[model samples]
Target: MRRSFRVLLCLAATAVGLTTLSAPANAAAHNYVALGDSYSSGVGTGGTYSGGGCKRSTNAYPQLWANTHAPASFNFAACSGATTTDVLNSQLGSLTARTTLVTISIGGNDAGFVDVITTCTLGSDSTCVNRVEQGKTFARNTLPARLDNVYSAIRQRSPSARVVVLGYPRFYKVPGSCNVGLSDTKRSAINSGADVLAQVTAQRAAAAGFTFVDIRGAWTGHEICSGDWWLNSLTWPVEESYHPNKNGQARGYLPALNAVTG
Candidate 1:
């Protein structure tokens, strides 16, 4: 009777130990890495994230997704003021064979979208047009190759990872009523420039066989001139100006990403 009782105790202990080892509640399996510029880094969103000057946001889409889904590893490599070359040199290091998911929004800084916007907001109409034209020329002639390089690097790093490329939203609402911040001429020029940039970005993203989310479409009624704006207009912190606010990341960007990822 004593030997039988001892054997039963040992069996129960082994079963409990195995169950604990095998059934960890929070064990992660998927690896997700986010790479890009201020938009991806969440600079426009209030409150900063880790990673030095990258200015990543806890409220950014990548972090929001990871917060709920809880991937095995989440690397937020996107940085503020990051260009395609910056990404190639700095951000790609976070990727590896284990990376299963990646997201990026690049090329805007390469074309100097912010500078063009500044020119439009403060300078004369023709100045804005000329600046915008310059930006469009760069987008057409140079941005495609730069985008291709970034996409190629992403592919090489994470061959099987699902890469989602998101594009910038148009800044102004055409025929909008407010008429306060920028002139109609400037607004139209900016919008048309955005269209050109999106076209180039979408083309390169498609060529890479990656998913491209058009936040322009997602943010139609919520642009800078709309009554309920997702993007910030000219404001303090200067960098946050023209960038998406917290609501933009949560509602505009996050939902756009989710629709594709799901």
Candidate 2:
């Protein structure tokens, strides 16, 4: 009887060890998908990826977020010029039951960020201001609905996955002594629009039962004119303009990190 009992104990321990070893192998087969725009794609920040040209970068924020927090089986579907709708119709097809995480940073392009830049560089004063205000309205009104659709589709596709909605950082600084070509009134208008955008995104996050990672606060002192700005100034030193650089991407990661794990 003692010998029989010893044999049974050994069999049970072997079974447990096999289960433990297989668990990681099973998990390794799962997936994670990242969906968003250039901010998520890591353009201009460096770290080129194969096959994506400049649209996708290995060092982008979502990839950074994934490296820091995601499961091992994740794929970044972020493109530089992707709009909110692009995420739902294209990026989401990559997800399956094995998918476990989805992170997004969108709505900027849909709100006419491209037009803002293009029109500003070429248009006259009235045309620029008018275009900016028009874009602001679109961002405030149309973007939330687009975000809602994308968020909902992601939830439907990957029911068990963790979703993260990342907010945009403050682009312009508050009015101060060092006013660049852009006026304080214009800056205030832009900031107000951005604030509204953040608010709506937060609301969408709550509705979808996902985490809303606010990048604005972490970017407070890192605006364009600050000595240690995360993003480069839009008006000068041409190589760095209108987007987050390495410092900005690095700084932006903190809020995302705090949101997912905290």
Candidate 3:
């Protein structure tokens, strides 16, 4: 009886040691890496980090999620004006085997979002509509393959990571009017561009086995023309125009990211 009791105690101690060893390994699996474009970088949201021209905001969704969840490690690699190629060339290095969570908002730049918005807002109505249609064409035709390459690279770099692809919110609230300078026709065109971006992004994300978070619905009543606008319109600093405001990051994006990642 005494020998049997001693053996049982030894086994229990060994089990406890094994559990202890595994705890940290499990925690380390929570390493997170954020990547993408101006939307992800929080360009128009007011704050900047490191001044490398990325304009990363403290209140961006990734940062907000990281602060709330307290992951084992967080790497913020999103940059303003980043296209699919930029992420492949510059940001993919941040991912590794241990990276378990990844979130990115991309493809807008590749679709010439900035250029489209600039042309639409400042040019003739016909010109604006034509530019927007061109953007949609790019999103449907060229953007997918570029996105596939980036997504594949990310998977290859961090095979274990759970990638979440976030899409843009529509800039204007439709069926309503505002004194924000954009004609109803121009607003419709720009919003159509946003829809195209979301659709293409969703398709690419699905193909890559990543979760695509569409912010359009969540941002429905809070678009640029709404009384409670989440997206900025033609701000003094031209760079600030068309991006999400700080409130948008906090209320709009943070909740969406949390829902998927949680």
| TM-score per candidate, chains pooled | 0.87, 0.79, 0.90
Tell me the tens digit of each residue's lDDT in model 3 across 40-129.
888778755643887788878888888888889999999988999999999999999989999999999999998998898789999999
Candidate number with the higher lDDT (1 or 2):
1
Better of 2 and 3 by lDDT: 3
User: Taking the candidates one at a time, how many backbone clashes does each contain?
Assistant: 0, 1, 0
For residues 18-42, what per-residue lDDT tens digits would candidate 1 score against the true structure?
9989985342566999999999889
Q: lDDT for model 1, please.
A: 0.89
Query: What residue pairs are clashing in model 1?
Result: none
Pairs with backbone N, CA or C atoms under 3 Å apart (clashes), candidate 3: none
Residue 240 displacement (Å), model 3: 1.0
lDDT of each: 0.89, 0.72, 0.89
Tell me the spans in candidate 2 whose CA falls farther than 4 Å from its real position. 1-30, 47-54, 120-129, 176-180, 235-240
Tens-digit lDDT track of model 2 for 1-262: 9999999999999999998888643333336687888777776564445435426766666666556654578787877778877787778887776677777888888888767756655666567678778877786687778888988888888898878788887777775446456666555655665777788889878888998888888888877666567775553434236778877776676455545644
Clashing pairs in 2: 42-60
Judging by lDDT, tell me the better candidate of 1 and 3: 1
RMSD of 2: 4.6
Ranking by TM-score: 3, 1, 2
